[model samples]
Target chain A: MRLWLPPVLLAVLLCGLSAGMPALEPLFHWVQPDKQQVIYERESFLFLLQNHLLLVLISAAVGTLVAVAGGIFATRPSGRDFLPLVSQVASIGQTFPPVAVLALAVPVLGFGEAPILVALMLYGLLPILRNTLAGLEGISPAVKEAARGMGMSPLQVLVRAELPLAGRVILAGIRTSVTINIATAAIGSTIGARTLGDPVIAGLVNGNTAYVLQGAILIGLLALATDSLFEALERTWDRRFSPQVAV
Target chain B: MSVSRSESSQLMPNRVIPALGLLALALVWLLDVGTIQPNRIVPGTGHGLVSAVGWGGAALVTSTLAGSILLAFLNLRGRYLIQLALLGLSLALLPLLLDVFASRHLPEDSPFARSSIGAGFWCLLFFLFLMLIETLGRLGSRRGLELLLVVVIGGSWLIFLQSEGLESLSLVREFNARPAKFEQAFWTHLALAFGAVAISAVLAFGLALKMMRSPGWQRPILGLVSFLQTIPSLAVFGLLIAPLSALVAAFPVLETLGIRGIGWTPALLALVAYSLLPMVRNTFVALTEVPENLADAGRGMGMNERQLFFKLKLPLALPVIIEGVRITTIQAIGLTAVAALIGAGGFGSFIFQGLGQAAMDLVLLGALPTIALALLADAVFTMLAASLKPTPATA
Candidate 1:
């Protein structure tokens, strides 16, 4: 039922971004390399796009590893101590705006992807970490006891038993993180790495809203599309183990 | 679930970690001072106050130690005396650390580095000390209320009184010394924040209520808001510019209506759009969470939907609704600063100025307030949230 809203809206946004853009390419023909290329290079939008997959993949990969590990530790009585610390830290990340992180990071990392990466890492950690913690904790102890009594190794039990059970929730967290990462990545543009936010910043300066519109709509569409895709994935995963709904 | 007994037991006086960390840091310092048996055994002090990683490590260790100390203290007597002693000791150590680092030739003028490093140490200590105190006697209790009144009145008075000499604070000085242009810039920045929050609250509540009461509309509204949430703030600004420029141009009346380019109108609109989803989503979830039985009972008792919504659903959802506003408020303040990129002004005045001039101080003027604003907003909202909680049945 929820499948259509995001993608359809995204398509409309992306369509307007590309098709409705003003024909300013000809106006700047005489100065510098073509406007598009010059803007592309200057804004470094291409550079960000070039690194987009790597950024998303790395953030997701590390997030998955830490979150899962943290989740395991969190679910145990003995290892429960770190949960408050990690979640508190996560809330701090959300509460303290990304601009603050970017400001603080500038001196240490000295700008570019390092600042973006660190901010993104902090921003992305919460959902995945919290959800991993939540998902594992949500599992009934009886289910785990039954598995343990059957002689499943801890590793096997986690991988073949608990993880599958927690997959849907964990994936939801990843989806949250991913969508958040895209928005945080726009802050990257403010610092000069340039992703979808380049045109938006340019538009602000030029007083041409379309440029901002173009980039914003694309990024929005990207986030929505990705989110919708993840939601679809979530449903599919949820259905696999829940027999009543699966049939 | 309650924490284990092991968690509670760790709160006792063996708060050995901070003392040991300080000892290790001192040892490192002595070696760096050429006072050690083996030079390698002496940790070399890095230029930026014991090095970045070391500072961060020390902070983490100290925070944990502090946390453990608080845990231990809650079950002890004379906790205030204990905390006072710890504050005095840390205050005493700070000057020595400052001297050792001063001799090491780190920049004394580096407030960010120094404050951040020092704050890292202090916050963990403060939080550790206060967490137990807070949880043990949280706001609904009589003592808690007294403490609250004292702290709030004291804190507010200090800030208000201090506003007289706000320029004395180095950061605040730069803020005050900025030109008229920056002041103008600040007004626009404030307008954007004020406008965004206002619009977002209205839109969010409207949409939230609409979506919550009707399941048929849920997916689409959630998706729309989610989609709105996904849009880059910068892009929203970009998208609005062309259409708005033309619309204002056609009307001419709108310019008189206070519509302007790359200024308050569009920035406010962009921020409003950005801030909406969180509030809407939060309010809807909060309201819908009202017990189904209660709502059904209300209807059974002859309460119509409107009456029920106003009297019951709203009051119950107030806490979460306020929470969502808190998030949006913090976010809007930060985003409002970004509106400076378009020449709509506020603290972003200093941020964009600093960016332009490559002057970090200018950036700090804007950036620091923002951080403070966010923290203050969070603290105030959280306090309010505490007070709003239903009174516990003392029984």
Candidate 2:
């Protein structure tokens, strides 16, 4: 029963914010003189929300797969020597601003989801890769040796023992990557990829504070909701792993 | 042991393999293919390709080829001095090669017909980078060699700055057209990056210390900062606009003080906010990571809490705290580029302008400098942190 609290709370908060946006119109009017009571008219909140989520989901999914694969490959005996190089490349990817990536990608990919996806994937790759690498390395060698002694193959030991042990850390990485990308995906609107950033960009351009507020509020809510969901998952994983019963 | 010695002697630095790959690419693609092509406004316009041989770049090409061949022979010898000399020659030759290629190939009177650098130049630059890394790796302890390389590179760049040939390059053309604006943007970028770092560092230090004193405040403060971190810079800029404007409206004094909704005030605030997480997290970790036994020992010496913190904990944590500052400062430098979106002038203004104009070189002009700044910041902070680290004897 306690597990449902976060989602319920997030839903209520988001719904309230969205519904109350019209009432808060006067507050936004303080930003510009002409628009006394106006709401952002770019796209409906729900539609923008869906678009934002889809962008994040696609990027995070692709980013996680590639990063996890890279992480695993680097940890393998034959590939261990490349770990530093791989990590360095990942760090470089993170350090390059997503906006810059977007600017560069737009000319080649055109102004659309493709460029945004590329930028988001590159931006989100580091956390997952770093955490995955750390998680794999953190595994006690004795645990692996015991598994091998039990007649498990290397592949079996990795899939059944190693990955399961590393799941929590890897999940945390995915959470960080996904949540960060959720906010980042907003920047996609600058290049005409329809997302929550549309209102913000529009407000910025047209001096419509109401539009910016609407978009920012939604993005903030989305980030909070995703973060709470990850927290809930972490708690569940903690319960499953710990031997001691909950009080 | 003999086999190991032979292998070690025979093997070139690992970086050379990639260098060789780049050289191979240069040989196959760049030698026959165009080194520069006339930039076209219309898509798919048949601009004539100017190969290195056709563009009077044969001297540079021949030299580079000969240098690579020499490197291959010297690789087996594996002597550090020979490698260093060869590396120095390659580094010195590269800028001259670029200068010659640009001067010889690029047309002077045609503003419309810009000569874009082709695949060959890119391949050669990559090759040079690989060589530089390999040479640096081999001469790891020779800081003088690294300094010499920097001086040589800077000297060549200065020469390029005054060269008539470089004016034909699109990036240089962009700079020449708006030199004053470029200078303004550069200084603005530096000021914003450094100002945000300074403010955030102070605030972060105070907050971190407070959190340390009250253990319960740590989690909430960290959580808030991390939450701020998760908010995109664009969103933060958007969020600030309304409230900031309201503040300005209420107090005309702020407007008089240069506070506005879409400029430096909001940009600085956002940059400082974004910077706080790294600063706070680093300080918190550094403070907490101080060994309990060390603190106990200090206490045993009759030192009070203030003395213990100032004398022992701070000195030990200084390096880590500086590391935090480094990360925050670098991150701030990058984020300041995004601040240009809000009318806060920086290098990003050029980037967005270039993007609007659909000029790739102009984008590179803005982006290249920003990247250089970030890398420079990283290098400087790394050196500072290394210097601050206690020696093994002291530890």
Candidate 3:
């Protein structure tokens, strides 16, 4: 199977379902025969999908940048003293569940998109930070020495040698971070951020099975599509870079 | 050369403690240490460090932080021990810091008046703990020592909270109102999270064993579990409700047994489904990765396949399997909170209820315990895995 095929297929299906959801009213009517309104109409599916994707994307971008920078600094000579604490914090912080983090944020930051975004960014950064630290530290000393022997400065070695070697691991970290943020952002609707979870929360609040099914199907497809995209990206990175490492 | 240089640098003044100290000092003076509320719903007036705890408290806080920084810079022999002692004392005494604020500022006129911790106190506590953790790491402390420190600090805080001095604190006040309900929520949360973990562990072990015996079953099984995992928890819970309700409708006897479309039934099913990926993956990897030579040695010693399987592979696999349990338990505890939306009783019910009521304190009452539980699970499982691992010499 082609690497890109699955994600593309999933994406198309997700889009089609979101766009054509109202067209399937008869089917939903069968599912919820007692209900007068079988379909959720508080917010359009496409709009919620966009809002959800935007939240996840923005958080993933900011989290990747901040976590990567912090990871880099901790591994550097000047910041080495902070390494133990930083790495410890990264690992320990993850033990606090994302939902708990979201709940805690509302008290400090107040409810709405801001608190959820802050929570998502903070919580989502952990796995990425951990991966970044591990990737950078796992590089062989001999490899660094070789880079230095070839007249690379510390910065040059870092930019050229360290980062390239660590990039795959860092990407994997971002994948994990994005995967988590997607789910958390869906739950963010409860805290008042418009997301795909809105319909499901609405459905659950009122006895509407059709609404629940719509949201669940979309969220599931989005996750699948995003995950496959990452898989394809990782495969491409492996193909391009594994040859160099092997030599 | 680099190794010696790195070693020598270890003797240099520690940066982490001082950095944390300076930041905590700034935050304590800069932000409000506590707030005074008229009642549960009313927003409170925040009091800064000096105003809230008075000059004596402020002076004491400043000196302690400054002393920590000084200690970090002193380069004395066994400074980590000194730092650890100082930090641990400060952390254990932290609740009393709030007690001081509560006593100083709480209105005597209104019984409804309550005190809540402000951002500054949280910052101070957080930094102190961070500094303590850094100190512990620097000391290369044993797990036993770390656990003892936690127990000591945790015990002190528990004792202090139970005392009358902190009764006006919002979190405690929230707890006092619904003590029975709180207990029920605690038990319900534990039951759902652990119940799912227990069930999934058994199912995963069977699945993993099957995968071990037959390669063909591996991909599909893993694929199915991973697919389940990738879906959001809310989506899974939502999806489970329809089918479950239909089943209950179809079979009226199911309702008597407490199997319903919504509630713990769907919650547990969703949790178990979500847990399979980690549990199965870990068990499979652990069993497969057991050294072959050890198995041959067991066979040579006249052990039968069953004996060798249990004695060799299972023993070696136990730690990794426990690690999976660690991961699964943490995930389940969190998801169980989400399950409250489906009428499943847990800490999450408190969270969503609080969220609905727009009660920040109530939210804190819910969220804090959930976090504590997850952290506790993490620590317990980590220790279990560590203890179960074969030491280097034995391996």
Winning model by lDDT: 3
Docking class of 2: acceptable
Ranking by TM-score: 3, 2, 1
Please write out the lDDT profile of model 2 over residues A1-247, one tens digit for every residue. Answer: 5876986799688767765676776666654558754687557777777788888998989999999999998898867645655665566556665567666666445667888888888778888998899889898998899889999998998898888788889999999889768766887786668888888878777777778878888887778778888888888988786553222
- Candidate 3 runs further than 4 Å off: B1-10, B392-395
lDDT of 3 at B75: 59
DockQ of each: 0.43, 0.38, 0.86
For model 1, the stretches where C-alpha displacement exceeds 4 angstroms are A1-48, A206-214, A244-247, B1-173, B179-191, B212-215, B296-307, B391-395
Better of 1 and 3 by lDDT: 3
The weakest ten consecutive residues by lDDT in model 3 chain A span A35-44
Off by over 4 Å in 2: A1-4, A11-33, A107-110, A242-247, B1-105, B118-158
Winner of 1 and 2 under DockQ: 1
Ranking by DockQ: 3, 1, 2
Q: Write the per-residue lDDT of candidate 3 for residues A112-210, one digit (tens) a residue.
A: 999999999999999999999999999999999999999999999999999999999999999999999999999999999999999999999988989
Tens-place lDDT per residue, model 1, A20-130, is 434444432322232343232343433444465466667777777877787787666665544555555556556666666566555345557777787677667778888
Per-candidate RMSD, Å? 7.6, 4.5, 2.0
Q: How far out, in Å, is residue B113 in model 3?
A: 1.1
Better of 2 and 3 by DockQ: 3
Task: Please give the range of 10 consecutive residues that has the lowest summed lDDT in model 1 chain B.
Answer: B33-42
